[model samples]
Target: MGLGGTAKKIQTLAEKAEQTYQRLNDLREEVEKTQETVTETGDRVRQLETEMAEQRAVLDAVAEEVGVDLEAVSTDAHITEAESDDEADDAGDDGSADTDGDDEAVDDDS
Candidate 1:
Protein backbone atom coordinates (compact mmCIF):
# COMPACT_ATOMS: atom_id res chain seq x y z
CA MET A 1 0.00 0.00 0.00
CA GLY A 2 1.08 3.62 -0.52
CA LEU A 3 1.90 6.10 2.30
CA GLY A 4 -1.45 7.85 1.58
CA GLY A 5 -3.33 4.58 2.24
CA THR A 6 -1.41 4.03 5.48
CA ALA A 7 -2.17 7.58 6.63
CA LYS A 8 -5.86 7.09 5.80
CA LYS A 9 -5.98 3.89 7.88
CA ILE A 10 -4.29 5.67 10.81
CA GLN A 11 -6.77 8.55 10.57
CA THR A 12 -9.68 6.11 10.63
CA LEU A 13 -8.26 4.38 13.67
CA ALA A 14 -7.77 7.71 15.49
CA GLU A 15 -11.37 8.72 14.76
CA LYS A 16 -12.65 5.38 16.15
CA ALA A 17 -10.46 5.83 19.26
CA GLU A 18 -11.84 9.33 19.86
CA GLN A 19 -15.43 8.09 19.50
CA THR A 20 -14.75 5.25 21.94
CA TYR A 21 -13.21 7.66 24.46
CA GLN A 22 -16.26 9.96 24.29
CA ARG A 23 -18.63 7.01 24.78
CA LEU A 24 -16.59 5.85 27.79
CA ASN A 25 -16.80 9.33 29.37
CA ASP A 26 -20.53 9.45 28.71
CA LEU A 27 -21.00 6.00 30.32
CA ARG A 28 -18.95 7.06 33.37
CA GLU A 29 -21.12 10.14 33.85
CA GLU A 30 -24.28 8.04 33.61
CA VAL A 31 -22.90 5.55 36.16
CA GLU A 32 -22.07 8.35 38.62
CA LYS A 33 -25.56 9.83 38.23
CA THR A 34 -27.14 6.43 38.80
CA GLN A 35 -25.02 5.90 41.92
CA GLU A 36 -26.12 9.29 43.31
CA THR A 37 -29.76 8.38 42.64
CA VAL A 38 -29.36 4.97 44.35
CA THR A 39 -27.72 6.55 47.40
CA GLU A 40 -30.54 9.11 47.70
CA THR A 41 -33.16 6.35 47.36
CA GLY A 42 -31.44 4.26 50.05
CA ASP A 43 -31.35 7.24 52.45
CA ARG A 44 -35.02 7.91 51.79
CA VAL A 45 -35.89 4.26 52.44
CA ARG A 46 -34.04 4.37 55.78
CA GLN A 47 -35.87 7.55 56.75
CA LEU A 48 -39.22 5.95 55.86
CA GLU A 49 -38.34 2.83 57.87
CA THR A 50 -37.52 4.92 60.93
CA GLU A 51 -40.84 6.77 60.60
CA MET A 52 -42.73 3.48 60.31
CA ALA A 53 -41.05 2.12 63.47
CA GLU A 54 -41.96 5.26 65.38
CA GLN A 55 -45.57 5.07 64.17
CA ARG A 56 -45.82 1.41 65.15
CA ALA A 57 -44.48 2.14 68.61
CA VAL A 58 -47.10 4.86 69.16
CA LEU A 59 -49.88 2.58 67.85
CA ASP A 60 -48.79 -0.23 70.17
CA ALA A 61 -48.83 2.13 73.18
CA VAL A 62 -52.29 3.39 72.26
CA ALA A 63 -53.59 -0.13 71.79
CA GLU A 64 -52.23 -1.06 75.23
CA GLU A 65 -53.96 1.93 76.85
CA VAL A 66 -57.21 0.97 75.14
CA GLY A 67 -56.92 -2.64 76.31
CA VAL A 68 -56.76 -3.93 72.73
CA ASP A 69 -54.86 -7.18 72.15
CA LEU A 70 -52.45 -5.80 69.53
CA GLU A 71 -50.82 -9.14 68.80
CA ALA A 72 -54.15 -10.92 68.32
CA VAL A 73 -55.45 -8.06 66.22
CA SER A 74 -52.36 -8.19 64.03
CA THR A 75 -52.74 -11.95 63.58
CA ASP A 76 -56.41 -11.61 62.72
CA ALA A 77 -55.66 -8.84 60.25
CA HIS A 78 -53.03 -11.02 58.53
CA ILE A 79 -55.44 -13.95 58.40
CA THR A 80 -58.20 -11.79 56.95
CA GLU A 81 -55.84 -10.38 54.33
CA ALA A 82 -54.69 -13.86 53.35
CA GLU A 83 -58.24 -15.13 53.12
CA SER A 84 -59.25 -12.16 51.00
CA ASP A 85 -56.30 -12.66 48.67
CA ASP A 86 -57.09 -16.36 48.34
CA GLU A 87 -60.71 -15.61 47.50
CA ALA A 88 -59.66 -13.08 44.88
CA ASP A 89 -57.22 -15.51 43.32
CA ASP A 90 -59.84 -18.20 43.22
CA ALA A 91 -62.35 -15.86 41.66
CA GLY A 92 -59.85 -14.80 39.01
CA ASP A 93 -58.90 -18.43 38.33
CA ASP A 94 -62.41 -19.36 37.10
CA GLY A 95 -61.62 -18.43 33.51
CA SER A 96 -58.01 -19.64 33.29
CA ALA A 97 -58.26 -23.34 34.22
CA ASP A 98 -55.01 -25.19 35.23
CA THR A 99 -52.68 -23.35 32.86
CA ASP A 100 -50.37 -21.66 35.38
CA GLY A 101 -47.96 -24.61 35.58
CA ASP A 102 -47.97 -25.08 31.82
CA ASP A 103 -47.29 -21.39 31.32
CA GLU A 104 -44.34 -21.54 33.71
CA ALA A 105 -42.88 -24.51 31.82
CA VAL A 106 -43.28 -22.71 28.52
CA ASP A 107 -41.58 -19.63 29.95
CA ASP A 108 -38.67 -21.78 31.14
CA ASP A 109 -38.32 -23.30 27.69
CA SER A 110 -38.21 -19.84 26.15
Candidate 2:
Protein backbone atom coordinates (compact mmCIF):
# COMPACT_ATOMS: atom_id res chain seq x y z
CA MET A 1 0.00 0.00 0.00
CA GLY A 2 0.97 3.65 -0.54
CA LEU A 3 2.36 5.64 2.45
CA GLY A 4 -0.56 8.13 2.16
CA GLY A 5 -3.11 5.32 2.30
CA THR A 6 -1.42 3.75 5.37
CA ALA A 7 -1.34 7.17 7.12
CA LYS A 8 -5.06 7.80 6.42
CA LYS A 9 -6.02 4.32 7.74
CA ILE A 10 -3.99 4.88 10.94
CA GLN A 11 -5.69 8.25 11.45
CA THR A 12 -9.18 6.74 11.04
CA LEU A 13 -8.36 3.95 13.51
CA ALA A 14 -7.01 6.48 16.05
CA GLU A 15 -10.18 8.60 15.77
CA LYS A 16 -12.40 5.56 16.28
CA ALA A 17 -10.33 4.45 19.34
CA GLU A 18 -10.53 7.94 20.88
CA GLN A 19 -14.31 8.07 20.41
CA THR A 20 -14.66 4.61 22.02
CA TYR A 21 -12.50 5.72 24.95
CA GLN A 22 -14.60 8.86 25.49
CA ARG A 23 -17.82 6.85 25.41
CA LEU A 24 -16.42 4.33 27.92
CA ASN A 25 -15.33 7.17 30.25
CA ASP A 26 -18.81 8.75 30.08
CA LEU A 27 -20.48 5.39 30.83
CA ARG A 28 -18.15 4.82 33.79
CA GLU A 29 -19.03 8.25 35.24
CA GLU A 30 -22.75 7.57 34.86
CA VAL A 31 -22.39 4.23 36.67
CA GLU A 32 -20.57 5.98 39.53
CA LYS A 33 -23.35 8.57 39.82
CA THR A 34 -26.01 5.82 39.94
CA GLN A 35 -24.08 4.03 42.71
CA GLU A 36 -23.94 7.22 44.79
CA THR A 37 -27.70 7.76 44.39
CA VAL A 38 -28.43 4.16 45.48
CA THR A 39 -26.22 4.58 48.55
CA GLU A 40 -27.98 7.81 49.52
CA THR A 41 -31.41 6.22 49.12
CA GLY A 42 -30.41 3.27 51.32
CA ASP A 43 -29.17 5.64 54.04
CA ARG A 44 -32.43 7.61 53.96
CA VAL A 45 -34.50 4.41 54.25
CA ARG A 46 -32.45 3.28 57.26
CA GLN A 47 -32.90 6.66 58.96
CA LEU A 48 -36.65 6.56 58.42
CA GLU A 49 -36.83 3.03 59.85
CA THR A 50 -34.96 4.15 62.99
CA GLU A 51 -37.24 7.16 63.46
CA MET A 52 -40.33 4.96 63.11
CA ALA A 53 -39.01 2.51 65.69
CA GLU A 54 -38.35 5.34 68.19
CA GLN A 55 -41.84 6.79 67.71
CA ARG A 56 -43.39 3.37 68.24
CA ALA A 57 -41.45 2.93 71.48
CA VAL A 58 -42.63 6.33 72.75
CA LEU A 59 -46.24 5.49 71.93
CA ASP A 60 -45.97 2.13 73.74
CA ALA A 61 -44.60 3.87 76.85
CA VAL A 62 -47.37 6.47 76.79
CA ALA A 63 -49.99 3.78 76.38
CA GLU A 64 -48.60 1.96 79.43
CA GLU A 65 -48.55 5.16 81.52
CA VAL A 66 -52.16 5.98 80.62
CA GLY A 67 -53.46 2.52 81.65
CA VAL A 68 -54.34 1.76 78.06
CA ASP A 69 -53.60 -1.76 76.90
CA LEU A 70 -51.84 -1.21 73.60
CA GLU A 71 -53.26 -4.34 72.05
CA ALA A 72 -56.82 -3.46 73.11
CA VAL A 73 -56.47 0.14 71.89
CA SER A 74 -55.07 -1.03 68.63
CA THR A 75 -57.94 -3.49 68.13
CA ASP A 76 -61.58 -2.74 67.24
CA ALA A 77 -62.93 -4.32 70.46
CA HIS A 78 -62.74 -1.02 72.39
CA ILE A 79 -64.91 0.70 69.82
CA THR A 80 -67.36 -2.20 69.74
CA GLU A 81 -67.87 -2.16 73.50
CA ALA A 82 -70.92 -0.02 74.29
CA GLU A 83 -71.30 2.16 77.39
CA SER A 84 -74.25 1.54 79.71
CA ASP A 85 -76.80 4.29 80.48
CA ASP A 86 -75.82 4.18 84.17
CA GLU A 87 -72.18 4.60 83.29
CA ALA A 88 -72.99 7.57 81.05
CA ASP A 89 -75.06 9.19 83.81
CA ASP A 90 -72.24 8.77 86.31
CA ALA A 91 -69.73 10.22 83.84
CA GLY A 92 -71.92 13.33 83.26
CA ASP A 93 -72.76 14.11 86.95
CA ASP A 94 -69.33 15.12 88.33
CA GLY A 95 -66.74 14.35 85.58
CA SER A 96 -64.82 12.79 88.47
CA ALA A 97 -66.07 9.37 87.47
CA ASP A 98 -63.96 9.41 84.32
CA THR A 99 -60.76 11.04 85.61
CA ASP A 100 -60.72 9.45 89.05
CA GLY A 101 -61.37 5.95 87.76
CA ASP A 102 -58.66 6.33 85.09
CA ASP A 103 -56.09 7.53 87.63
CA GLU A 104 -56.99 4.78 90.09
CA ALA A 105 -56.85 2.16 87.40
CA VAL A 106 -53.42 3.22 86.32
CA ASP A 107 -52.17 3.31 89.91
CA ASP A 108 -53.63 -0.10 90.64
CA ASP A 109 -51.91 -1.61 87.58
CA SER A 110 -48.55 -0.23 88.71
Candidate 3:
Protein backbone atom coordinates (compact mmCIF):
# COMPACT_ATOMS: atom_id res chain seq x y z
CA MET A 1 0.00 0.00 0.00
CA GLY A 2 2.82 2.41 0.89
CA LEU A 3 4.60 1.79 -2.46
CA GLY A 4 1.37 2.37 -4.39
CA GLY A 5 0.77 5.73 -2.60
CA THR A 6 4.36 6.82 -3.33
CA ALA A 7 3.97 5.93 -7.03
CA LYS A 8 0.82 7.98 -7.33
CA LYS A 9 2.48 11.02 -5.69
CA ILE A 10 5.45 10.76 -8.10
CA GLN A 11 3.15 10.60 -11.10
CA THR A 12 1.25 13.66 -9.93
CA LEU A 13 4.52 15.53 -9.40
CA ALA A 14 5.70 14.63 -12.94
CA GLU A 15 2.48 15.87 -14.48
CA LYS A 16 2.78 19.22 -12.68
CA ALA A 17 6.37 19.62 -13.83
CA GLU A 18 5.39 18.93 -17.42
CA GLN A 19 2.64 21.52 -17.22
CA THR A 20 5.07 24.07 -15.80
CA TYR A 21 7.57 23.44 -18.61
CA GLN A 22 4.83 23.89 -21.25
CA ARG A 23 3.78 27.15 -19.66
CA LEU A 24 7.37 28.40 -19.70
CA ASN A 25 7.72 27.54 -23.38
CA ASP A 26 4.49 29.34 -24.15
CA LEU A 27 5.70 32.44 -22.31
CA ARG A 28 9.04 32.34 -24.16
CA GLU A 29 7.29 32.23 -27.53
CA GLU A 30 5.04 35.14 -26.59
CA VAL A 31 8.04 37.20 -25.49
CA GLU A 32 9.89 36.48 -28.71
CA LYS A 33 6.93 37.53 -30.85
CA THR A 34 6.54 40.72 -28.84
CA GLN A 35 10.22 41.55 -29.31
CA GLU A 36 9.97 40.99 -33.07
CA THR A 37 6.95 43.23 -33.31
CA VAL A 38 8.70 45.95 -31.34
CA THR A 39 11.71 45.80 -33.66
CA GLU A 40 9.51 46.04 -36.78
CA THR A 41 7.54 48.95 -35.36
CA GLY A 42 10.75 50.79 -34.50
CA ASP A 43 12.05 50.36 -38.03
CA ARG A 44 8.78 51.60 -39.51
CA VAL A 45 8.81 54.72 -37.32
CA ARG A 46 12.34 55.59 -38.40
CA GLN A 47 11.38 55.15 -42.05
CA LEU A 48 8.41 57.46 -41.61
CA GLU A 49 10.56 60.04 -39.86
CA THR A 50 13.02 60.02 -42.73
CA GLU A 51 10.21 60.36 -45.27
CA MET A 52 8.70 63.28 -43.37
CA ALA A 53 12.07 65.03 -43.21
CA GLU A 54 12.50 64.65 -46.95
CA GLN A 55 9.03 66.03 -47.58
CA ARG A 56 9.81 68.99 -45.32
CA ALA A 57 12.95 69.66 -47.33
CA VAL A 58 10.96 69.64 -50.55
CA LEU A 59 8.39 71.98 -49.04
CA ASP A 60 11.16 74.35 -47.99
CA ALA A 61 12.65 74.27 -51.47
CA VAL A 62 9.30 75.09 -53.03
CA ALA A 63 8.82 77.94 -50.59
CA GLU A 64 12.26 79.34 -51.50
CA GLU A 65 11.53 79.08 -55.20
CA VAL A 66 8.44 81.25 -54.66
CA GLY A 67 10.64 83.89 -52.91
CA VAL A 68 8.70 83.39 -49.66
CA ASP A 69 10.11 82.73 -46.19
CA LEU A 70 9.55 79.10 -45.35
CA GLU A 71 10.26 79.88 -41.71
CA ALA A 72 7.22 82.16 -41.62
CA VAL A 73 4.76 79.65 -43.05
CA SER A 74 2.72 79.45 -39.86
CA THR A 75 -1.00 78.76 -39.58
CA ASP A 76 -1.75 82.48 -39.70
CA ALA A 77 0.37 82.90 -42.81
CA HIS A 78 -1.45 80.00 -44.45
CA ILE A 79 -4.83 81.59 -43.73
CA THR A 80 -3.71 85.01 -44.90
CA GLU A 81 -2.08 83.58 -48.01
CA ALA A 82 -5.26 81.70 -48.83
CA GLU A 83 -7.32 84.89 -48.47
CA SER A 84 -4.81 86.84 -50.55
CA ASP A 85 -5.01 84.21 -53.26
CA ASP A 86 -8.79 84.44 -53.25
CA GLU A 87 -8.62 88.21 -53.60
CA ALA A 88 -6.14 87.96 -56.46
CA ASP A 89 -8.36 85.43 -58.16
CA ASP A 90 -11.45 87.61 -57.73
CA ALA A 91 -9.64 90.68 -59.07
CA GLY A 92 -8.16 88.75 -62.01
CA ASP A 93 -4.64 89.83 -61.01
CA ASP A 94 -1.70 87.83 -62.29
CA GLY A 95 1.24 90.11 -61.60
CA SER A 96 1.41 89.89 -57.79
CA ALA A 97 3.22 86.59 -57.33
CA ASP A 98 5.76 86.44 -54.51
CA THR A 99 8.78 85.76 -56.75
CA ASP A 100 11.24 88.61 -57.32
CA GLY A 101 12.45 89.21 -60.90
CA ASP A 102 15.51 91.01 -59.54
CA ASP A 103 16.59 87.84 -57.74
CA GLU A 104 16.75 86.07 -61.08
CA ALA A 105 18.66 88.99 -62.56
CA VAL A 106 21.18 88.81 -59.71
CA ASP A 107 21.55 85.10 -60.23
CA ASP A 108 22.17 85.70 -63.91
CA ASP A 109 24.81 88.32 -63.07
CA SER A 110 26.52 85.87 -60.71
Candidate 4:
Protein backbone atom coordinates (compact mmCIF):
# COMPACT_ATOMS: atom_id res chain seq x y z
CA MET A 1 0.00 0.00 0.00
CA GLY A 2 0.95 3.64 -0.50
CA LEU A 3 1.71 6.07 2.37
CA GLY A 4 -1.78 7.61 2.01
CA GLY A 5 -3.51 4.28 2.51
CA THR A 6 -1.25 3.45 5.47
CA ALA A 7 -2.06 6.82 7.11
CA LYS A 8 -5.84 6.27 6.70
CA LYS A 9 -5.60 2.81 8.30
CA ILE A 10 -3.62 4.26 11.21
CA GLN A 11 -6.23 7.00 11.74
CA THR A 12 -9.07 4.48 11.77
CA LEU A 13 -7.23 2.26 14.25
CA ALA A 14 -6.60 5.25 16.52
CA GLU A 15 -10.27 6.20 16.44
CA LYS A 16 -11.29 2.66 17.33
CA ALA A 17 -8.79 2.56 20.20
CA GLU A 18 -10.14 5.84 21.56
CA GLN A 19 -13.67 4.55 21.39
CA THR A 20 -12.66 1.34 23.19
CA TYR A 21 -10.93 3.30 25.95
CA GLN A 22 -14.03 5.49 26.45
CA ARG A 23 -16.23 2.41 26.72
CA LEU A 24 -13.89 0.83 29.29
CA ASN A 25 -13.91 4.03 31.36
CA ASP A 26 -17.70 4.16 31.28
CA LEU A 27 -17.92 0.54 32.39
CA ARG A 28 -15.53 1.18 35.24
CA GLU A 29 -17.66 4.09 36.48
CA GLU A 30 -20.75 1.94 36.37
CA VAL A 31 -19.02 -0.82 38.36
CA GLU A 32 -17.95 1.71 41.01
CA LYS A 33 -21.51 3.03 41.33
CA THR A 34 -22.85 -0.50 41.63
CA GLN A 35 -20.38 -1.36 44.37
CA GLU A 36 -21.35 1.75 46.32
CA THR A 37 -25.03 0.89 46.01
CA VAL A 38 -24.40 -2.68 47.15
CA THR A 39 -22.45 -1.44 50.16
CA GLU A 40 -25.26 0.95 51.13
CA THR A 41 -27.84 -1.80 50.77
CA GLY A 42 -25.77 -4.15 52.90
CA ASP A 43 -25.47 -1.51 55.61
CA ARG A 44 -29.22 -1.02 55.65
CA VAL A 45 -29.83 -4.75 55.84
CA ARG A 46 -27.45 -5.15 58.77
CA GLN A 47 -29.11 -2.25 60.57
CA LEU A 48 -32.51 -3.79 60.06
CA GLU A 49 -31.34 -7.15 61.38
CA THR A 50 -29.96 -5.52 64.51
CA GLU A 51 -33.20 -3.65 65.10
CA MET A 52 -35.22 -6.83 64.59
CA ALA A 53 -33.06 -8.68 67.13
CA GLU A 54 -33.60 -5.90 69.67
CA GLN A 55 -37.33 -5.92 69.09
CA ARG A 56 -37.45 -9.69 69.42
CA ALA A 57 -35.64 -9.49 72.76
CA VAL A 58 -38.22 -7.04 74.08
CA LEU A 59 -41.04 -9.20 72.76
CA ASP A 60 -39.64 -12.26 74.52
CA ALA A 61 -39.36 -10.40 77.82
CA VAL A 62 -42.92 -9.14 77.57
CA ALA A 63 -44.26 -12.53 76.62
CA GLU A 64 -42.49 -14.12 79.57
CA GLU A 65 -43.93 -11.57 81.96
CA VAL A 66 -47.45 -12.20 80.55
CA GLY A 67 -47.08 -15.98 81.12
CA VAL A 68 -47.17 -16.65 77.38
CA ASP A 69 -45.03 -19.48 76.05
CA LEU A 70 -43.14 -17.78 73.26
CA GLU A 71 -42.03 -21.00 71.58
CA ALA A 72 -45.54 -22.39 71.53
CA VAL A 73 -46.91 -19.10 70.22
CA SER A 74 -44.30 -19.03 67.52
CA THR A 75 -45.05 -22.60 66.48
CA ASP A 76 -48.79 -21.94 66.45
CA ALA A 77 -48.29 -18.82 64.35
CA HIS A 78 -46.23 -20.77 61.80
CA ILE A 79 -48.82 -23.52 61.59
CA THR A 80 -51.64 -21.05 61.10
CA GLU A 81 -49.67 -19.21 58.40
CA ALA A 82 -48.92 -22.47 56.60
CA GLU A 83 -52.59 -23.50 56.75
CA SER A 84 -53.66 -20.15 55.32
CA ASP A 85 -51.13 -20.45 52.49
CA ASP A 86 -52.27 -23.98 51.72
CA GLU A 87 -55.92 -22.97 51.65
CA ALA A 88 -55.17 -20.06 49.33
CA ASP A 89 -53.17 -22.33 47.03
CA ASP A 90 -55.99 -24.85 46.94
CA ALA A 91 -58.50 -22.12 46.13
CA GLY A 92 -56.28 -20.83 43.33
CA ASP A 93 -55.84 -24.31 41.86
CA ASP A 94 -59.61 -24.88 41.73
CA GLY A 95 -59.99 -21.70 39.63
CA SER A 96 -63.10 -20.80 41.58
CA ALA A 97 -63.85 -17.19 42.38
CA ASP A 98 -64.04 -17.38 46.15
CA THR A 99 -65.40 -14.34 47.91
CA ASP A 100 -62.98 -12.34 50.06
CA GLY A 101 -65.60 -12.02 52.82
CA ASP A 102 -65.64 -15.78 53.38
CA ASP A 103 -61.86 -15.93 53.54
CA GLU A 104 -61.75 -13.00 55.94
CA ALA A 105 -64.26 -14.62 58.24
CA VAL A 106 -62.29 -17.85 58.42
CA ASP A 107 -59.08 -15.92 59.12
CA ASP A 108 -60.77 -13.90 61.89
CA ASP A 109 -62.05 -17.04 63.61
CA SER A 110 -58.58 -18.58 63.68
Strongest candidate by lDDT: 1
Candidate 2, residues 1-110, lDDT tens digits: the string is 69999999999999999999999999999999999999999999999999999999999999899898888776656555544555775566663545655666654653
Q: Which ten residues in a row have the lowest lDDT in candidate 1?
A: 94-103
Instruction: Please say which candidate is ahead in TM-score: 1 or 2.
Output: 1
Candidate order (lDDT):
1, 4, 3, 2
Q: For residue 57, give model 1's deviation from the true position in Å.
A: 0.8
For model 4, the superposed segments whose C-alpha errors exceed 4 Å read: 95-110
Name the top TM-score candidate.
1
Question: Candidate 4: lDDT of 6?
Answer: 95
Q: Estimate each model's TM-score.
A: 0.82, 0.59, 0.64, 0.78
Question: How much lDDT does each candidate structure score?
Answer: 0.89, 0.83, 0.85, 0.89
Per-residue lDDT of 5-69 in model 3, one digit per residue for the tens? 99999999999999999999999999999999999999999999999999989988898898986
Which scores better on lDDT, 2 or 4? 4
Q: For candidate 1, lDDT tens digit of each residue in 41-94? A: 999999999999999999999999999998899999999999999899667755
Q: Which 10 consecutive positions of candidate 2 have the poorest summed lDDT?
A: 77-86
Q: After superposition on all CA atoms, what RMSD does each candidate show versus the true structure? A: 5.2, 19.2, 19.4, 8.3
| Residue-level lDDT tens digits of model 4 in 9-109 | 99999999999999999999999999999999999999999999999999999999999998899999999999999999777754244355466555555
Give Cα distance to truth, residue 2, candidate 1, Å: 1.2
